[model samples]
Target: MKYVVVIGDGMVDLPLKELDGKTPLQQAKTPNMDFIAKNGSCGMLQTVPPGMAPGSDVANLSIMGYDPKKYYTGRGPLEAASIGAELSDDDVGFRCNFITEDEGRLDDFNAGHISTAEASQLIEALNQHFYRYGKFYLGTSYRHLFVYKKKDAATLESTPPHDVVGEPITEHLLKPENDPLAIKLNELMYKTSKILEKHPVNQKRLDKGKKLANMIWLWGQGTKPQMPPFVDTYGIKGATITGVDLIKGIGTYLGLTNVHVPGATGYYDTDYCGKVNFALEALQDHDLVFIHVEAPDEAGHAGDIQEKILAIERIDRRILGKLLEELPSLGDYAIAILPDHPTPIDVRTHTSDPIPYAMYSPGCESDKTEAYNESSVENSFKNSSKELMEGYKFLKFFIDYSQCKKA
Candidate 1:
């Protein structure tokens, strides 16, 4: 049986008064997602475990059947894997973000979703300037990797720029009590800011009235991770399709095939239809295919409620709609759809909320869920609580519903 998992990253949200107290998922036109709920079993899946930070790295690992508490080292090493960067036993990798700063305040975490071409140039300049401390390698857009040639590099306490949008950078800068690496990282960020402020890229961006990619924010540091191959974990050949390096990195480390779709950006303008087409082709040989869409999450981070609704609608029409129409030709398949975590529009960051999920396996008894949303699954179906089924176990239960059904 073919297993398909589509992750709408950070698509879940709280009710908003703007939409008459209805969430984006509740109000958006998601007929395809609704159809999955109508035909299959629906429930809530706590992607983030208790006492864990609700980052995509931890959450997606749980969703993919790997216990993050055991397998997760950090976000940096994961992205490093996507870029094919080899880390030594003592070396540590860091997720270096190109950010925009204004008047000592953190302006934009994404540097206005900077293009890969422009960001590559900026990363090259940073490497040229700071060749002594560490080396920077370009990933995609603002997301890049920095390999620090030191063992204690992971101990530095740094905050994610997304978590401190509009806050003073001085308040959130890296704080290391006695660690010299942390002090150098903080100094590098400040020095990079001054250099990039005078660079031609920022000058052109300023002239064009675009947000400048003026500073480097370092966080999410870790060493290499040890994970079994996807086949060994599930006893099935699987592949992953995503626009973000973090997801691709996880897939890479697990020895899963990473399918790249042209024009797949980790933003609202990402190619949803392209991802759908690629995933369909991947399922021709693979037993399982995992597709991740980052648009809804980007919208949530921007607090663009309408854009989030539009993103969900696009996924329903361009991705899920096409999948349901074409999967019948492939073979007997089970499709699971849910978000990794909630990037609530109000909070504008990841939250530790149990996300709603739906799984449609042929011949499985439907729980009579009519719509797919935060509230519908709770009210209409008898669902499993986070206390009952952990996120890492959800995949095992999804792929082997017969065994789980009897248990």
Candidate 2:
């Protein structure tokens, strides 16, 4: 089976500072992607809907032609279920994060780049002490993947209390103010902190000149997803290569395997070559490969435009370049690469705008474009989402329109 490899970092788009300012793609050097966009079909895609609450989770589903409202139960359980964590009809799931909380004020976020092991230990410790019918699962360190179930609906109403970055976690917490059932969350938060404070793993890392994993704050609490399995719906197996817990969790929830490679970094400084290799190999074992990179969004979230550009450029050369180089050897497969959403470096938040998108079928179009952006591809025949779906109508038509082909 031929596979369409979707390669791009996870979402967290920016509100481009200047109306006419260059996009991250325009600013970054993406020769191979630019070449693909120009050689084949390209256009502006509103991967997310016209007016939907935006997130990488929803954008990806939309790009794949799944309606967000129909498919997204919530992103948390998908990530949770990805890591072997399970949820039920009565259960609630949340994305818990081990961000840097101040030891002095306990107010600051971004706890100095805490490592995953420290975060995992903290979650394990938190997991050890659960009262009644609630459960918390730790994922990839920075993300605390949690699930809860109560017999009564009242038990699940309280939600994760996070509004903006750097908001006092103390002020925004599981409380009666937000949820009557939130009384026990602050206890869990304090417990998770104390456990991290003395964790031998953290202490050992600190001794090794590594950042100490500190506090955890819960956010993105959501319900379990109900989307049909890809194999069931698309007649093809799918797998993802990513470190971000939510995407991994989603892949897991959908029963998609998370690809692991030798020398895999599992984070921003990840091995880009390793990711492309995973995509190429997936062609043999599966029908679709979802290669999710996290660094660009991380850079954008950090307000580091230069770093975001570097991440994009680096991936373009290392990951995207390697994939294209190997394409000739692996005949008959098409490549479609698009971002789940725009991660504008300066703004560092998910923005609702049509992003530049493209698809490349070998021998379809021979000319490579110099760059990739919104306005470059509208003049071509590959004008709609259906035309861009790599010979399948499953994505753009929102149904089983796979009775025909362009290849």
Candidate 3:
């Protein structure tokens, strides 16, 4: 028996009036997702635990069966691992986003989705100036990273740039008084902004009438954390396929191989079929393969309803559709599909609401769900309580069930 988990990041959403009060999942044509719901048990899973932030760091950790309260440190350390930035015990990691600011207001969080090559040059310039206090490493596009040598920096409170888009930048500067290391971080950000504003990169962007990647926003700080490897926890080797560093970082620490798929950009333009091809090939050697798609989440953050719907349809057709058609040839397998959290279109951020999930196994009992969406799962739950279960709990159950069947 084999296992596959498909995570459509921030795929869940609230109902929209434009779609006749239907959520994107309901409005989108997701035949493959609907097929899973029809043949498998469906339920609402609370991926984000109580009192935890609804970021992918905590949510994906919980989805993988590790309790966030026990294992989660911060988002920075995870991304650090993905980019091969080794951190010492005393070092702290931070996610440094290259953003655009205008007239003291927060503009684009992604700086017009700046190209990695261009962002790399900007990060290199930042390293030349601030390499003594902390070092900057380019990851992807505006999603870069910084590692602070001081442990106290990990305690600093910084807001995610995405959460503060279109707001005043002054109101959201990092609070540094609480920690001396934070003071350094706050000071560095100001200095870096001044330097970046006049840099050649910003000048070029201005010439093009593009959003300038003028400032570095720091958030999601933490030291390296210790957690049991996934193989030890599940007794099955696994691989991960994702374009996002945070998810790939989690997989790296969990002893999972990261499958790099060309053109898998973690955006709407990502090559969806490439991810499916890599995942299928990975399954040939591993017992489990996890695939994460970030397009829906990005669309949600941009508050573009049509893009979100289109992303969902693409995942259904390109990723899951290909897997369902090919996996049967390999052997008996179970596929679990769910989002890490809800990036609602209206809110343009993650919500702590429970997300709907479906698990399809050969010859397994069905919940009679016809489509994969929030409303359909709610209706299915009303008919039977057997499908209702916690998100983290399902991970363990799925592993054990597959192990038993394999034996």
Candidate 4:
């Protein structure tokens, strides 16, 4: 049997008063997702484990069938793997984001969604000045990496920039303020601001009235992780299609092929159709293909209600709609749709909420869910015996649910 999982990253949201008190999922037209819910099963899955921060790295790891508590090191190491930045045992990889600091506040986490070409030049200047501390590796956009040789640096508590936008930068810098490593890293961040402030890239951005990537905010640090490959754990060869480096990094470590699609931008303009087309092509050789879209998540983070709704619709129409049409050619396929976690439009950050999911496989008994959305799944979940399943267990349940009917 073939398997496909479409992950609409941070697609779920709380009910917003502006959207007529309906969540984005409820407000958006998702007939394809609703079809799966109607024909298959619908319930909630706790993608982010209790007590863990609801970052994409943790949540997606859980969805990929690896318990985050057991396997998650940090977000940095994952992106490092995706960008081909090898981390040594003593090296602590930190997720370096080019952010805008205004009047000592964290003005913007993404530096106005700076272009990759502009970021590349900034990355080069950073490495030139900070080579003694660590080398910066360019990933994409404002997302980058810095590998510090000291393992102790991993213990420093650095806050995610996206989580604290408009907050005082000093209040959120590397914590336990007395630690030497924390002090050093925090000082490095301040120094970075000086270098970036005068750079030609920032000068051009200033001329254009764009947010300056004038400071590097470092967080999510960890050494390399030790885990079994995807095939060893699940006995299925899987591939991943995503624009985000973090997802690609997870796939890299799990022995899953990272299918590169030129139009997958990890932004609002990301090519939804191209991602599905690539996943379909990858399925020709892979047992399972995970199609992860980041646009919805980006909209959620930006708190753009219309954009989030648009992204959800695009996923339903362009990705899931197409996948439903084409998967039948492969025969006996199981298709599942769910988000990694809730990046509530109001909250504007990842939340540890149980995400709704719908899965369909020919011949399996359906729960008769009429729609795919937060409210629909919650109502269905109350009537079903399946409580909120753990994120890691969902993969096994999905595969077994499909295989049991064949047997």
Sorting all predicted structures by TM-score, with the top scorer first, yields 4, 1, 3, 2
Alpha carbon lDDT of each predicted model: 0.89, 0.62, 0.88, 0.94
User: Runs in model 1 with CA error above 4 Å?
Assistant: 381-388, 402-407
Superposition error at 404 for model 4 (Å):
3.4
> Compared to the true structure, candidate 4 yields what TM-score?
0.99
Model 4: C-alpha RMSD to truth?
0.7
Cα error, candidate 4, residue 71 (Å): 0.7
User: TM-score of the candidate numbered 1?
Assistant: 0.97
Tell me model 3's lDDT, rounded to 2 decimals: 0.88
List TM-score per model, in order.
Answer: 0.97, 0.81, 0.96, 0.99
What's the lDDT for candidate 2? 0.62
* Candidate 2 lDDT over residue span 243-291, tens digit each: 6666766666566777776554444677887778777887677766777
Candidate 4 per-residue lDDT over residues 74-172, each given as its tens digit? 999999999999998999999999999999999999999999999999999999998999999999999999999999988889899999999999999
- Candidate that would win on TM-score: 4
Which should have the higher TM-score, number 1 or number 4? 4
Q: Write the per-residue lDDT of candidate 1 for residues 131-197, one digit (tens) a residue.
A: 9988999999999999999878787787889999999998887776456776788889999988898
Ranking by lDDT: 4, 1, 3, 2
The 10-residue segment with the lowest total lDDT in model 2: 396-405
